[model samples]
Target: MQETLACFKAYDVRGQVPEQLNEDIVRRIGRAYAEAIRPGNVVVGHDIRLTSESLKQALIDGLREQGVDVTDIGLCGTEEIYFATAHLGVGGGIVVTASHNPKDYNGLKFVREASKPISGDSGLREIQHLAERNVFEATAKRGGYQTADLLGDYVAHLLSYVDITSLKPLRIVCNAGNGGAGRVIDALEPHLPFTFITQNHEADGHFPNGVPNPLLVENRSPTTALLQSSNADFGIAWDGDFDRCFFFDAAGNFIEGYYIVGLLAGAFIEKNGPQRVVHDPRLTWNTIAVVEGAGGEAVQSKTGHAFIKEKMREADAIYGGEMSAHHYFRDFAYCDSGMIPWLLVAELMAQRNQSLAEMIAARAAMFPCSGEINRKVEDPRALMRAVEAYYAQGCTHIAHVDGLSIEFDDWRFNLRSSNTEPVVRLNVETRGDVEKMKQKTEELLRFIDG
Candidate 1:
């Protein structure tokens, strides 16, 4: 009997190193992926994690054994694999990255042709099943492997989204948190007119400071402190793989990702004129208002990269943004990038001659929100149902796109259970009513805990 693999998740592979994810398992994954997807050629890259390189080599060996040509772009962020896959016209792409997970953990993210995500709904389940069975027919031909440096092209593609000449000489703070973003920043520095103050910028798998996760409030201290001390116009922080980026205002205020979503939606509309903007259903008021106000259509999708990307393709949206700081661009193969967002926001600041805080103030005030709060509960589904039963009568609108989202005339909230844990996440917002938003949040928490 074969030992079952536990690293496979709903959308990707993630688990603790050595125990759940070892070289052998990754090698099996490569063979399974090749057999299931049957890609003639694949782009493979790895993050700065200590184990990533070895795991990637094992994966390459398995793929090459199965006659799958490999294009290795070493030591890259997750977005680079997406870019290389679409840019090189490869059959598939895989990036070995855990993206903000603890140092003991690692994972892999995958994309197929055109840089489309490979989630459970797509081919991830099949890949996981095949890997578990650990059976592959021997191939006569061994696939060739080659190394390519596409950094120049990838940087060029990122710069194409903004007007280089229009960027102002603003001072900015960039905190890479010892992740993979610093390399890309170094490459982009020469092309822009901004002065950057970098902290924990080097790629260190040991994570000298901590895991490169900006979502946690505690993890944001370094970036905020640096922004204030340096007197920079704004601050930006990225996750381990740099696929998601969070922002801070000149005042050292961490701006919520929801408002950035609105800002980008409006910017895209102003630039391209009435294009569809896809957004997650978790926080809808601000995004919907901004999109429609700019004469663009706002299409709501279930939260997650796979769903958002699929919705973007279906609507041919110019851009899509999730409150989690994942911004997707149509030009970037409908894939999310941490770099493109700041570049575009910088251009907007330059063009409007306004600070990031000034631009976001009105929208944020108009739609005050309580950022996501997570709670560990015995039955997340039951809690959500009880909350829904209590509020359903008063809510003017209800949606089940990703979870339970109930909307009243002036206030709304979304409650969803985590896919991999026994935790439920809650988000609340009120139209121009901070007190109401706070009150509703407290009420919900009390009820949820009760």
Candidate 2:
């Protein structure tokens, strides 16, 4: 067995198939996870990837070998598995998905009861060690496997999060990117008044067009063009496994996730009446401004699903968001979902009688950002230290919540290393000054590249 750090990410197991991750490794992970959690019953689900079924079966075999009963939810998204785990009140759950990675890639995401994420600090490191060691004490009797379809309950739970009955007729374009999101939309469209112009709605493991990741500029074109041509109110797209979602306005412009964060924060605040909201430190001015303006509290947290979920539970926040399109909800046990954001956004539009662009236009000018920029560097920590040293001299405030973040009266920026990739992500925002934001972003990029 080869020892590689790539499979051990901050949150879940992920790697290129048959190299860092394969059937043998996945089976071992299943056994190890079963032993670690020692759940009497475990729920498992898979995406549309070709390898998903095989990997899931191997995992189930390992779990059963350890006398852990397995409940299989076939061909579901990550959030569905989370729903199954919580709704069924099971011991824990695992999702068999690489989540927006290439088809040749596959991985697993584990959670304890109520879909609580498993991290390195929690139980992931132990699982990794066990998986690498490839040794486990066998049980006297093997566990049994049972199949269940929880899609109905999952869909109902999602709809209950938003008031669709009061929504007006709104035309929207949905680009599933040919992933697992299409089925959920199909089930919900009949129950709502909104008209959906769907594209790439098929669930294809090959991802016929490209990977489902909306962060890539190239992936936004199809959804943008479809929204423009259809003159839809707005458009939404999801990555593979449909955990995170992105939105596009009626003008076919891709709205930054930060703006959506503010929108969702405001919506939740209006309904829930000024509660706490959690946001990642990388991009937070808009979120903070919105939450504070609405008489709510804005709590900053480190970037990652596990950290955000933990913060949400601790703060009892109504909602939380990361700039990378991951939105977490208190109602969903602090689990991120690709399906819920748009539902609430649509409801906000219907209730306000305004278009999505109109609602976000005012906030857009309050804080213009250069979007996240990534740089491949040799020493991420050294570069971050240098940037912090440069900015700390004159900045009014600085923080190391996740990485280096410096805040001046008029501008602020955060530079952090990726947990799963060999790169550093830099995000800079200025108080409605595009030129300054651009200049500072360039300066930081140069420093990182140097």
Show model 2 residue runs off by greater than 4 Å: 1-6
User: Please, what is the whole-model Cα lDDT of each candidate in the order they appear?
Assistant: 0.95, 0.90
| RMSD of every prediction | 0.7, 1.3
Q: Candidate 1 at residue 194, lDDT?
A: 91
Ten residues in sequence with the least summed lDDT for candidate 2:
1-10
lDDT of 1 by residue, 207-257 (tens): 989999999999999888888788899999999999999999997899999
> Model 1 compared with the native: what TM-score?
0.99
Each candidate: how many clashes?
0, 0
In candidate 1 the C-alpha lDDT for residue 294 amounts to 89
lDDT of 1 at 280: 93
Question: Which tens-of-lDDT digit does each residue in 149-239 have in candidate 2?
Answer: 8888888999998777789898889999889999999999888998899999999999898889999887899999998799799999999
Summed over model 2, clashes come to 0
